[model samples]
Target: MPIKTTKKVTNKKVVKEETKPAVEAKKEEVKTAEVKKATKPAVEIKKEEVKPAETKKAPAKKATTKKAAKPAVEAKKEEVKPAEVKKAPAKKATTKKAAKPAVEAKKEEVKPAEKKKATAKKTTKKATTKTTTTKKVTTKKMTKEEQYAKLSLDTCLDLAKAMSMNVTRDSIIQQLILNPDVKSVSKDLVNKYQLTGKFNFEEDGYDEGLVEVLVSKVYETADIKPQKAEDLQADVDHALNYKFTDVVADGEEYKAQFDTMRKVLMIAQHKDIHDSKNLDEEIGIDVEKFVEEFMDLAYSVLKTWKYEDVDYYEHFIYAVLSQLEDLHDTYRNRIMMDVADLYILHGDYGLGDADYGYILRENQIKDYIYYRYASIYEGVDKDKAKQIANQALQFVDDRFTYYPNIIAVLEG
Candidate 1:
């Protein structure tokens, strides 16, 4: 009975030992509950924080699944659509069917173009093979004026200007031909411009219409010479002024204007005296009497005739005066002296001023006029002649100062 009781006790102790740990666990749970009760607000706050974390992870997991599915869905859909198939392929097909005629028309159009391309390629191949036909060479011939009209004067002159040869119009024309700008045409135009008898070398000699076109580009675009600038400028001026117009006008105003200038110029000059008139006789030379008589005719013309009606008064005036001053004959002197006397008598010193303008135009004229005047007065007024001859020196060009005529006049 005692051993059974002891065995029962041992079994109870083993069972009790396990039960005691369980009891301690129950006690820990009770204490943990009390502790949790004391920290319940903190536990609730941490649970709230963990809830947002869990919520964020929930959406992330859901989003990852949807992202994977979306790609799979889009890829599967794309596999059926192709690039342009989803775009109204029926309308596109109809448009393509409608464009068939245009395509056929384009193909028809391209046929001739392809033929031309093939022909051009064949020509190119032929050209490369060192076989030039005579027909190709002969097709490009041109006339002289036609060829000349094509080239700028600079292009024509480039060859001559390169060689530093004479660059005259004639010289340029001659050289440009040798460059063989299409051979014969260049040669003929050059010969025509340079070798013609009818072509004038002076300003008025140029074609008035041609002058208008060439003058603006004389130096820059054309091959004209520096010495020819003045000549060309004069031509353009003449073309712009008197020469372009017809000389016919009311009452022969043109002729009258030109004639009157010459008449007045002749009337203004001092007369040359003869040997008999030089001596102290009744017929003795009196330049004052000569001046008085000539001034009468000059005044008559100034009152009766016109001087300003001419188109080229400037040109005419100078030319007239130049002619009168060149007069060395006694008859010319007598006629001109009578005209001079008339001008002073009429109180129209305008003609004298015009004469002075002509003298002042060129140094040559100024010197010549003075020399002529002093020659007439040499015996009558030696002191005055010496003064007049000295005055002539001032009018002579610097280069011509030591000229033989100047030295002889100085000594005389």
Candidate 2:
């Protein structure tokens, strides 16, 4: 029994030892719980501090997002603006390039037009210079004496002016009385003055109105050498013998008839001058075919009549002029000069109702007409002579070969 009890005590000791170890394990767990409670407060404090910073950062993040969005919108607008600007500059550059070629083309076109204008101006200047030079040459050609040998009333008037003499009616009468034939007297005068060929004295002894009388007077006064006489005579004879084939105011047929009548009248006048008896019956002029020729012959003869023969020929002159009044006469102006001489010099102004002043006023007076008018007015009316001369200035042509004669009468 004692042994059994001791064994039980030892068993209890074993149980106690095990139980004490369990109690110690429970104490350690409680201590761990307390330590966790203390750490919880610290952890809560840290979380509280971190929460405030996180709250502030949330608003900052929102503001940063809004700023980013605004910048993106502005960048989009900037991209669009840059695209438009680049396109506009490109279009402008293209237009400038196109316009440069057009401007260059216009400049090229203007260059040719400017050259043409310059050439035209040069041509006009040359033309004017050439015209002036031609005129100067013509004037210089006229002064030579050899050029004077081509004498004609209408062709070489300049030469006539140089050779013409201003003689009186008394001088002509005296010259005629000295020799019955004025041609023979002219021949003597031409020989005496050593001017046989220069003075054209017709061998036929035909009197050509005032021309014959004037030639004789000029022969006496001219200081020409005998050697030049033949040239002057040939020129004058050629001019007189030149046929009137050119159409005048009348047609060629009328001119032919006029030439024939002039020849007949010239023959009749020659016969009357040499022989006192009228040759109208002998020349068959009073016949029906020659009646018109007869009247023309009588009229031409009256023009060359002496001052003493005016009374004898007054009736005949009236009859011839009255017959001419109805016809469309080419010699109407020439006939008027004879009428004027009769009225002014003689006592016959019997031209019925014809205006002498109106005839004179007609501007149809040419260079040849001026010569006849001036000769009529020379001794009788000096004022009329001067007035008629001054009026003829514009009628003078520069191109005429006989321009000098007309100038001499007007400007003398």
Candidate 3:
């Protein structure tokens, strides 16, 4: 009985807590009741907290609580009514406090419900988004290899043809290369090996294995350069700058030619003061030595090279002619020009024209030669001088129309 009364008093603290003296009185009453129960009834005792003063306001709160306690029913009712909706912090706080009794056991119990709520909320959000929004799912475009394959087949065929490859066979190979696994098998197959020079294939009647035979020839003609066209382009650049790679024999010989020619021009210009002003004072002595070294290196560099390529031969010949002219070796250059002319007449037309043009434009062979011959024959052989001048005119172009004036200078 005392235990029940103490519990009831503790519970009753809600309302009576407003009046401090009343709460103290209630506590004293609970103590007396416990004493009475202990003393009078060792047998049995029952106590009712039926005091109207104590129970009246408490029941109203209890009635309110019973309505609030059935949260499911109350939520349903609120849903139906829709008018009693209100924010209630005190309700939330009380609910949180009441939940503390079994918080440990209930925490686990509440987990699945919270998870279900979360899942449902997520589902609803996704469904709403699906209805209200439009989105595009994009994938990456083709990678480089894929793009290369995706190019038009016609474009591939044209590219192969321009590169002097057999179109059908190369196209098959290129198409096979669409598969990376297969592409690895042919990494070294379609290499860029150049087949230079002119050769008659009409009598050969389209040799089926010409490409292979030509590649073999390149190895023989140009040394087995295995680094693809990368090295070939570099070779061209070096040649343009009058240079050769160290791989060539006597690779510095062209430097010597230039060095001799450079000194000839310098010495010819400053001959009156050569005793005092040195070549070093004019262009530093080291420049002449450096060019000499280059020529020494280039001496036999062209030995292995055949004059088979028309353009390469022409450029080589022109460089020699220019160097010779720089050294005032016009007579020696005439012999070189005759050598080039003989080679061109053998079949190469391009080199022929280049040699002819060099002589005609420089007025070396036409003006100087005719003048030299005419001066030697002047008065002593007037008929011979006129005949030589007329012969010179036949070879000269209108660009060198001053040949007659050159002849008149010789005559004077």
Give all candidates' CA lDDT scores. Answer: 0.36, 0.40, 0.38
Top lDDT: which candidate number?
2
Clashes of each: 12, 5, 18
lDDT of 2 by residue, 26-133 (tens): 454435333222222233223323443343343212112223222212221222233333433222222232222222322333344455567667978999999999
- Predicted structure 2, TM vs. truth: 0.24
* Per-residue accuracy of model 1 over 1-412 as CA lDDT, tens digit each: 7955553433332222121222233454434333222322233233323343343343212112222222211222222223323332222222233222222322332344445567667878988764556665665576544444555655545533333333455433322212212234334433545433433324322222232122222334433222222223333232223321222332243343333333233223222222222311322223233322333323333433444322123333333333334322333333343333234234444564344445445334455455554554454555655665676677665565344444455577
Please report, as a residue range, the 10-residue window in candidate 3 with the lowest summed lDDT.
Answer: 39-48
Candidate 3 per-residue lDDT over residues 1-412, each given as its tens digit: 7976664543332212111222233454434333222222212112223343443333222113223222321222222211222322222332333322222212332343455567667979999887665432232344444434444545544444554665354333322222212333233234432423322334432222243332332223332112232323343234335644455433344544433433333342334222212433543333234333433343344433444432333333334333334322433444445444444434444564465556666665466544554454454556655765677766654566557665574355
lDDT of 1 at 324: 37
Which candidate has the top score in TM-score? Answer: 3
Provide the lDDT at 328 for model 2.
19
For model 1, what is the error of residue 69's alpha carbon versus the real structure, in angstroms, after optimal superposition?
60
Better of 1 and 3 by lDDT: 3
Which candidate order results from sorting by lDDT in descending order? Answer: 2, 3, 1
Which scores greater on lDDT, model 2 or model 3? 2
What's the lDDT for residue 228 in model 2? Answer: 26
